[model samples]
Target: MVARPDLTAWRPAVAGVAEVLHAHFTDHVYPMHAHGTWTLLIVDDGMVRYDLDRHEHGALSDLVTLLPPHVPHNGCPVTPRGFRKRVLYLDADVLGEEHIGRAVDGPALDDPLLRRRIHQLHTVLAERGEDLEAESRLSLICERLLGHLGRRVPPPPSRPDRSGLARRLRDLLDERVLEGLTLQEAAGLLHAHPTHLVRAFSREFGIAPHQYLTACRVDRARRLLLEGQPAHAVAAGTGFCDQSHLARNFKRIVGAGPGWYARAVREPASRS
Candidate 1:
């Protein structure tokens, strides 16, 4: 079969996701390049052959191809007619490195139901549907993928230390840093006393809960900025009160303001 011409389109970031790409490739081969975000991919037609961490992987339409952030991988079609694929580049920090590590161990997931659900979520996102509905689907998709990958989600603190209340609190902070959650609220949800929870968290992590939440927010803002989002918008999107608020925290944590960080991150790509 004669190969079709290549086509590609990039969509702007949504929520904690950095960007989406829908592309069709014929003879095109991606060189050795790795994304700064997790590459969650769907092959719509034909197959994609790629190498992750020196191991080759061939993914058909039934499977989802997951490449963890900063891991080297490259791709090309396995068939002459080539392939059509959609990709979601998600902020790595939002997903947590430990969970990503589990997926990286086995990058291709052969779950048809999960694939369909992810495709549906992608459709809603690409079409820019209702914000609440999209958010709901995104949450469900994350939960399903985490479970499918055999990574355990922490149960609420049966005993704080054994259950790792601090770790669970860290996950909670990452999830709601942008949306904002208070110490009292988080403690209530975890069934712990607020002051005790605070002390436990500090003792375990060496940083106050509020400080950790701020750091998470700053990290998220950095990803958005890297995606070319303006500082003001990033501030609002990442749960800061305003652009100035983002600037203050971002400079303190990141050693630069959001604008500078954005330019620094994008300049290499722009030059190339």
Candidate 2:
């Protein structure tokens, strides 16, 4: 008999996160141990049965499990096929110590919204130079977690004007189209919370801040392509991580790949 474990772990540049781990384990059992940071876990395949503070719990694909810091826990697969999971070890300060008890009591949360946000955060964390998007997503995730733990008080409903905030963010994005700023920097400059900034911009513009930025970059790439700049050079000039990154967003927004679009535009002149 042999054990196969596939694991990848890293410490992202984003604040409030201690580490990120993605793993798949077959025929493996974890001994009782504890972490100094909160474990935000999501199982992707199969199931994980674990014991936390002497209480047994099962981690299913749809649920988000939050194990508090310094609490002993052990995990193993619930099935013969084993389980695959993604985990984010958040810093202790990200969630106050006061909420530790609450989390321990209700470690497995069935909130779909939280699960989706955590998945999105993982995607952003995997990409380089996306710290702003990661931080913005993390802020909302923490707020939702606090709400789930019964520590966050819902804000009073007030219909104050938010169009100005959205426009300001738009202008900021436009000004820094090439060298993008972090969500924290925009919030500091505009005097708003990261979550609030995202909400305001989305509500007013009907698109997410990150999506809008990607669109802007793609639009710039189009212009450079038409000007006879190479696709790779345009991608670098327009702030994309690489040519493939540019191509993906370009196809999504422009209904064609960069190479195809460039050729199509030049084809008309060649025909003439």
Candidate 3:
């Protein structure tokens, strides 16, 4: 087997991102290994075969691969000259816990719009550092991805089942947000299917479980920030991946960065 110019490296600029890889292999086969972060891959050329949760997945060129954290998978080419692939390793915390089950169940997605956005994110991240534009693009990518992977809602039933399941899920989330509970864990504990659980929770609570968790983390971070904790310190306490992750979610939820929000809180108390 002849060697080809295969590139595997990291992109340092993006927050909550672990690495970037571009490679074309003729004989290399990735052994079964699991990453703790989300693996978003775009096939640039040829075809590749892999397995997720003991299910085989074959991805052609231009298709997107969304591998959830802690799933053991392996990969090799399906074509003669091997395949070309680009991948982004993203912190699982940034994507939240609700969609992890869907990603694990269906690693190869056929959404063209999602494929395009992921490719665009890769392009932008490769070229420049983290800025407003890059951040905006990342947000959009996540939004579209969540739409695909989140719970599916059908027509509203005349009387929605008010089983109080959503409330129970919310309580569970409130208690477990700092512990980083995954959708599978929650569903197993509740003795329900993950999709049904998500749909019911979203229908009753007006948001998915992961969204509620993020809000809980952000809300906790706010109180901590007001208590004079630094952003980095607050991040760890609130279960954020890092300060950047905290800052991004905090600014989005609070409309200001932690430092600024802290100042605003302090000024009001000082003036009082």
Candidate 4:
């Protein structure tokens, strides 16, 4: 087969995600190198064999491989068909320095839920106006990864009611709905860890913070659209990055696109 390597890499606006890369490589071998950020990888089409900290690992389609920051690793395809993979380069702060040794010890995870969550995170990160969603997804992914690495400590037996914290987060999200809010910003303002904030909000509200924010935006967009505002303007006025972003969320929540919803509201039905 001909040697052709396809790759796309971009830095998202989300805080923890340093970079996102999707690649399909044939006959391309990666030399031993280290990164300043965590490498979270998933193989889509084929397998990748890599060595991390003098031990070998395989990145299979079902596995979520996490190569810790500052750890040396090299990768190459397992077959002539090569490998197709998606990767997320996360900032060191996401996982902390304490987990690097554990990750280096066992870089590949066999958990299906983790692999699925990572996939969902990649999908959210690829979108322009989905920073909040990306942050939420990344938080869960990191939490699961920490669990996999045995870095997560169990909470105390006494469980305090975090409903107040969740309400505060909801209020903050409401105050900044139009301006947009990041998970880190919310965590800082609420004086809670990102994962804790996410858990609290989800548990109290029965919905993820990102989902709540999107619903709010969509509701606002509906009002604006009915008030004779164009779909594009409604998008900009309601915190969406663009008309398409608004359309995607609007359709999901409202069962129709912004333009269609607006038109349906304005147009009178024919008399029988």
For residues 1-272, write the lDDT of model 4, one tens digit per residue.
Answer: 56767999999998888899999998999999999999999999999999987888899999888999998899999998899999999999888988898888888789999888888988887778999888888888888888887877345122354788888999999999999899999988977878888888888889999999999999999889888999889999999988999999999999988878987885667899
lDDT of 2 at 271: 46
lDDT of 2 by residue, 1-272 (tens): 86768999999988889999999998889999999999999999999999998899999999999999999999999999999999999998888778889998999999999999999999889877667678879988998998988877345224354788888999999999888878878989998767788888888889988888888999899999999899999989999878887887799899999999988775444543
lDDT of each: 0.73, 0.88, 0.75, 0.88
Separate clash counts for every candidate:
0, 0, 0, 0
Residues forming the 10-long window of minimal summed lDDT in candidate 4: 152-161
The CA-based lDDT of model 2 is what? 0.88
TM-score of the candidate numbered 3?
0.54
**TM-score of every model?**
0.54, 0.90, 0.54, 0.93
**Model 1 misplaced stretches (Cα beyond 4 Å):** 1-13, 154-272
Residue 164, candidate 1: Cα error in Å is 26
Sum up the clashes in candidate 2: 0
